[model samples]
Target: MSVFIEKKKRLSNDSISQLEDELEDNPLDYNKWIKLIKQVMVKDKEEQIRNVFTKYLDIFKLDGEQWCKYINFEIGKGDFKKVEELFAKCITTVDNVELFRLYVSYVRRVNDVITGGEKARSTVISAFEFSVNRVGIDVKSGELWNDYSEFLKSWTPSQSWEKQQKIDLIRKLYKKLLVIPTEKVESMWSTYTKWENEVNSSTASRFIADKSAEFMEARAWNIEWNNITDKSLSRKVLPYGLDDSDKDNRKEIEQQLQYWYKWIEFESRNNLNLKDDDLLNKRIEYVYKQAIVSLPFVPELWYRYNQFLMNGPSTEDSNSLNMNIDILSQGLILNPKSYLLSFQLSELYEKETNLAKANEVINNLVNKLIQDHSQIIKQIEEINDKSIVKTQNINGDADNMDEDDVNKPKPGYFLSEHDIKSLKDLKLTEKELSRNITLVYTKLMMTNKRSSGIKESRQIFKQAKKFANIGFELYVENALMEYYSDNKKTANKVFELGLKTYGTNGKYLLAYLDYLIMVNEIESIKVLFEVSITNLLKEIEDPEGVDDMDTPVWIKNENLEKINNHKYFIKRLIKKYGKFATKFLDLGIVTSLEKRFKKYFPEDDELELFRSRYSYDSIDLIKYDLGKSVKYIEQDTRGDIDQFFDYDDETFDKNKRRKLDLPSKPKETAVANQPVIETQNGFIGESIYNLLRILPSASYYGNVEDHVFNSKKLVELFNSLDDIRNQ
Candidate 1:
């Protein structure tokens, strides 16, 4: 109960009316009474403070403390008129400068004064002048005459000081200082330096420079007016640290300074005229010497100087060329990996047809480019986090947030673990792709030159093509990881990312087919050709939309139209693979069908006729004993021989009787089924025709030995025949 009631304590007057009578006689007495009341309030004597103020208010009748307290009560009640009246009364009685300042501030804060605050302040100033003049102690007048004019100039007489007008006034004053006589500018510099050297004055001067209302403008004045010499400006600006904040602005300013500095130096060397040719040469030589001496490592400057020398008329240009080369040589000695200088030197050597040296330089450049690309790839790898699981807490201020949350950050993307790994692996794979592709492009380029090296270049191209294929495989994998499934933006980004990762790859064109799939944009035949097999399969669901219909086109127009181009593309691939397979066959056990046919068939007969008969579709033609046919043809000296007959089978006998109506030929009939034929002269015969007749026929029977032996012998004999024809 005591605690509850203690919170509701209100004013209880104990002291009496005598203090108010004294205050009425002297207004200073009221100030003293308020001061004592404040002291009681500070010491937690709140009850006493309230009692004295309340009792004095009743006694004075005019209520001086009550009048002051009314401002607070009025403000609390939002009563503007009562607040204004109490403020005016308080300000009139306020003798202390601090207290009067507080009263004016309060009046302004509430915006309830008699007039505008500025007009009220002016009235107070006039009244202050009158009262102080009468008393003969003018504080404001004395303050106005102080030695420091800076503070007075920047000082605000009204509350409107924060307005742009005041800021503009400060800016104008500083800019005006820039127009002062050059001597005054010099004097200011001397004064600044002197103050900066003194321990106590140094800090004060810096503080003034920083806190001055127009600091930036003043510094600009120093630069524009006082900075006549570079050395002087540099020294003056050292304390300012001109490159502190805005680097681009600083760079622009520095570029202008550098240009002017170079111009001045040029004028000094040439004596301000280009009329004298000898003097111009001297000036050029002087600048060249300076560049070589001052910037020994700047290849661009050296290159420029060399170009100028080459264009000049003097014989010394030749010497200059040599000197330029020598300088680069020296520079290269110091920095061997300077690609620009090396490239320049390589150009010089190549101009003289020194391709070996040029190639060496090119190789160096390629190595450096590769190294830089490798470093970038490594940096990208380092930044990509590859963790799988993460935990998170609900609260934002979760200090005990689970490690799993940190590990598995809320993804900006949707991708499975396999997808993430595939994407990461794809990035590294691109570097390999780029490097291999570059080598391939280089090899292909070398094939352009007509020289003895053409064969070697062709081999290089072959190797390049081999590696190009491998690179394409990796590139396709990367594109799939980028474009497939959730977070498919990876696919869209694959173009730019692949370029950065693998440079200008033909494979990127293939990768973009994934984008076409997601957006249903795969209408172009060209788009279909570039797509990988997997990408092509992805589009297989919509058979009527894609280019590669599984069935041929005349069967189904819409499906054929969709995949008309894809069928052609697949056919092309088959042709290519077929051609590729021949290489292995040519090098291995299988004789090319063309080689085998050429070996047995007569050169006089049309090859097409033989080809048709030997073709895979002509199974019945192939079923005939090729060896027997060859032997029979070799023995036929005349076109038609009745001796050529096979009467071994009833079918042959019947067909022959019907077609030829031949008489019984017993000897020929007996020779027909025999594996080896004997002549009437008792000649035992194993002829070339016999070998041809038996081998291929045996091969047709799935006799594995005939395939093994005949194919080898056919290629060997065909190769010999080609050699003889060439000779």
Candidate 2:
């Protein structure tokens, strides 16, 4: 309490420590990713450095700039195998132009005509083709196309067949590039025209004439593309780091996102009437890649892109489904917090009848939710003070006084040991998060039902109950599933279970009462009233003169509100039913079926004049906007919901049901779930497997498992061959 000079505390001056501290506060900060990488690069321990890189890349896997930095670091180390491994991990997900340039650069570095000869030249050509196939459609992919052209022109052949082959390859590459509406297509068209004339004077006219119409069309679009993207700034506009305090930058970022979205609309033919769906989808898909490369952290863009791909004319194409899966998976890596991408991916897998993978997507999402909730709870515990509790934002600074209010010493109020436990768990307080988890649980149950029947769905329900943060909706949904299955006893039991936990919850109570009324269960409804009222009565009285009770005003109000909600519900019930329908209706002087309403809430006309009105006959019904109705279970391969998993008694084999283990991060689960491939040296799962083998990563680079130059096993084989040659 003494007004003395306070000793200044100091922070560690170490750069790595400093960066780590900042990253802990905001992990998605792009600048920090760069600075931290640069800082760690100067260090000698490869393993430690690799660990740090992996840690960040797990979150920012689609960020092309960061991927290149890691790839370049590996290239400098001369670990070609490691470099390929790193590329494999990144190549599948990220569709960045910069990353492709690095890929080609590495190709040129290791495989050159001077030392490595024709085979190396062929390899380089293959690499360029692979890179061009995935990203050549991009407007910003001008440089990569140019590089590929330069490499082709640099080659000369010793044979007649080779000369013709080279010429044909050049024509093919030029024809492809000239028709694409990229930024540098016009310049390339000019160069191609000149080269065609130089190659064969007689056929140059025909070659030039063949592509002229398409070339002109592409050239017009490229100019129009530049018009739509005035001073085109998608690359320079970095997001994920700007704070609310930096208002100008935040505004700029928002504007940039809007601009990109508008550009996407333009590409998608929102303004233009491009009668060709195939050409339109391609253009839209290309723009989506460009936008995604620039704004990897935005989940909405990924989701929108997936929707476009799924709904477009391309859906009839065999590859569309795989394309959707790959896009959604990449989005999941960057934005694990987003529920949209996960739900979509899970549904897609379900559509494909891959039930295990469908469940895994949801399982992974719930796991992420748990991990995130745990982190939030830990942060709250660390920041929560014994005496002083910040009244506004829990995570904000305690000193909340304005400039003029500096004289006001007390910024926060006081808290007691008992008052700290939230009326609900801290985890459940995140309402949006809780709602998403509940939807996931419902989706999980639906998936289980579709696969193994109601027996499995019930198992999933039990697992969902283990999480404290899930909403009453899961119980509501589970009860409906049983009710729809014509298992009245099981449905009633599920409702009773829900009421026991959420006894005072007005929404769940109303829904339960409605179902009871719908089913004409008068006796069971009476039992519900008796059981639910017992616990709710404890908090029915208002607290005014009570002392030493440091109960926050909100909790007291909540209690009053709950009691009033029950009163209003009974009011609605009495309005529907007769006043003397039962003992509760007949005996009570309040003239209602609400048992203790007169005694507990005495009628007072004299005190009716409230300074603040109690307001509203409205009772909140808990509704999460689930796009798909949970109660509607359609026909599956097994059978209809009516015939699926029928139970005779009040029992199913609990032992027969599969257990969903608490999951790790999605990426970790992916690696750990890979099955062991049997080999001559017994069975061993390849530990070095990366997501690059994922089909979606390289749209054009079809099934490039590994290059021999980047394999240690191949290097050993090469050394042995050299030894044989020397002998």
Candidate 3:
């Protein structure tokens, strides 16, 4: 491998080497893998080709098309055994109808039904059965269902009893297919009814009667599916990456996620109007399964699905817990490093009272993360490529360089496939992975705490601290545990230790301050609050001062933290140190802090009470107005070059010098309203339509330009808007 890489370094434009180099940097790039595979195929080196395909499929286990590609590659080379092997592996790992279809296709090709024995026919039958058993629940799998039914119909027997059995089997299959709540169900119903009538009128009538309810349900499914399922949504679940700045792509991804949520809700809410709880549960589980197939790397879905199965109407105790374990375990396989999935899987085991298994699950995650963390971090540093040098092409000019810097490739010029998997299933960056590692450590600590006790948890926390690469949550969690265990001294010590490590981080400082407040460490709280605020402010690179700087989200968050810290301190110390509160939470600072955040709160009850308590300002209405309008008022203060909007109260259009006379009338009783809008209760909706009919319209007395703006309709619209605002 070293020699191969060394050889590649001398070949600047070698496609194979370049592709391999790119793949080494980002193994998850599917396009790169395809390019590499195509290049490899040119050489016809079967082993190397197989190796590449193996790695590709291993990463994208859910991609049935890729599996088909591999199988096709083998089949093209007349390697039937390899094709069969590939099909077996794909069928076991992937729940994809296309993959199953491909396998069925292969089975038919290999075993010629015309000349082959009963074994060949049996193989074909089994293939169809297996395909349906696995992926027949997919609503979009209309093609697969049609193919299976048609395939089964093709088989006919001559013996009287055998023919009857075949008819019975086909009837059973059709009946099952008809009720599956797929779009195909409509066509399936038509076919089933036709086939039944063809066989016998009496049998068809009875069969149709028995299936009327299911047929109705399937019809409802069709309607809901049509409404909810966006055909534009690509169900292809590839492990990919995303660029955060790509807002359009992000919106598309969010829309896809919402579509899945709708599908899940539709199933779980008895949207099909199913009478049976068991049927609803089955359908809900089916939707979750389909979602997982499309988003296997999404840990949250797995967690939610597991929770659904582990509790509520869907749960079945041991069965539910085991099911949760299986689902979560599968999620962990796809999202190998997902802390959330790992934690939940362990939680399931713990719930089962399998302490050893629970410990094993968390321990396994921590161990794997530990093994890969350093390497992943190292790869990131390499990807950063600090040694990059700007140069002129071929000319070797130092100062005179290519002008196409905008198109110049960076270290990560290619979109990361892992990110596209979220392209939230996308690969986590070094910082993100580090956070997950910390989370995993916390989970491990918790697992041990639950199973072993505080002593073990403390030791685990000590080890976590030694790692020193984690965030403050490790310390906070441990300290709180100690505090809750009636060891305030130990907890305080833990906090003090973390203070040295994370004093500058606003989050840690706030957490530490909260601890101080909870314990009523008055003097310590004062010192820590001052120290924390100072450290946090200094931590932000605000040498020019924060007052004039453009506050980005991160900066706003820091300032928000500062305000929260102040609020915590003031709320605790307000009565005894009202003057101190006034000094820190002074009007200007409070206004600036609040300007960055607005929860759209209904009212300021606390602020009103505080104002009532203190005679700080007599002009309460003016204060309130300023507070509400601060966002607009602070756009820019009076400066020589600053722009401001000046307005006059007597503003009017010269064209509308004459005010138009408009008729006004009181609202009439329901009897006088339009019959369309009238009811026993009262007139429904706006009633403007009927009111306009009754009020009458006056013509063209104003300037044509002012006509639309000054009309009664405009007045009504303004009134409606005012009503909304008042509400």
In the range 431-500, model 3's lDDT, one tens digit per residue, is: 5666777777787787778878899887778777666478788889888888988899999999999899
Better of 1 and 2 by lDDT: 2
Instruction: Estimate TM-scores for all models.
Output: 0.26, 0.63, 0.62
Q: Compose the digit string of candidate 2's lDDT tens values, residues 606-683.
A: 122120122122211111121211122256333533322221112213222211122332332222122322333644
Worst 10 residues of 1 by lDDT: 233-242
What are the Cα lDDT values of the candidates?
0.42, 0.68, 0.65
lDDT of 1 at 370: 58
Which model is ahead, 2 or 3, in terms of lDDT? Answer: 2
What is the number of residue pairs that collide in model 2?
A: 1
lDDT score of residue 135 within candidate 1: 17
Off by over 4 Å in 2: 1-13, 17-31, 44-49, 77-94, 114-123, 152-173, 189-211, 231-233, 236-264, 270-283, 307-327, 349-357, 371-385, 388-436, 468-470, 523-727
Measured over all alpha carbons after superposition, the RMSD of each candidate to the real structure, in angstroms, is: 39.0, 24.3, 14.2
lDDT of 1: 0.42
Residues 1-727 of candidate 1 have per-residue lDDT tens digits of: 8864543332123222334345555432334466555555455444465465554443332333344553454555666775566556544432222333334345445442244545654454444333322211111122221111242143454556544454444333333332222223444444434534442564656544543444343344335433333332221011111232668745544543454345335434543233667655654544453333333334455566556655677524556656556655554543344656776766655554666665566555555555555655664444343221221223233356666645434321334555455655655566664655464335333522322243444343344334322344333443344344343555445444444443323244434433444454435323343343334334444564234333223224544544545433333332332233344324231234335334433363343433333333212233254322211223443445544443222333211221222234332222222243334354555565343333322433465674566677889999999999999
Q: How many clashes show up per model?
A: 13, 1, 18
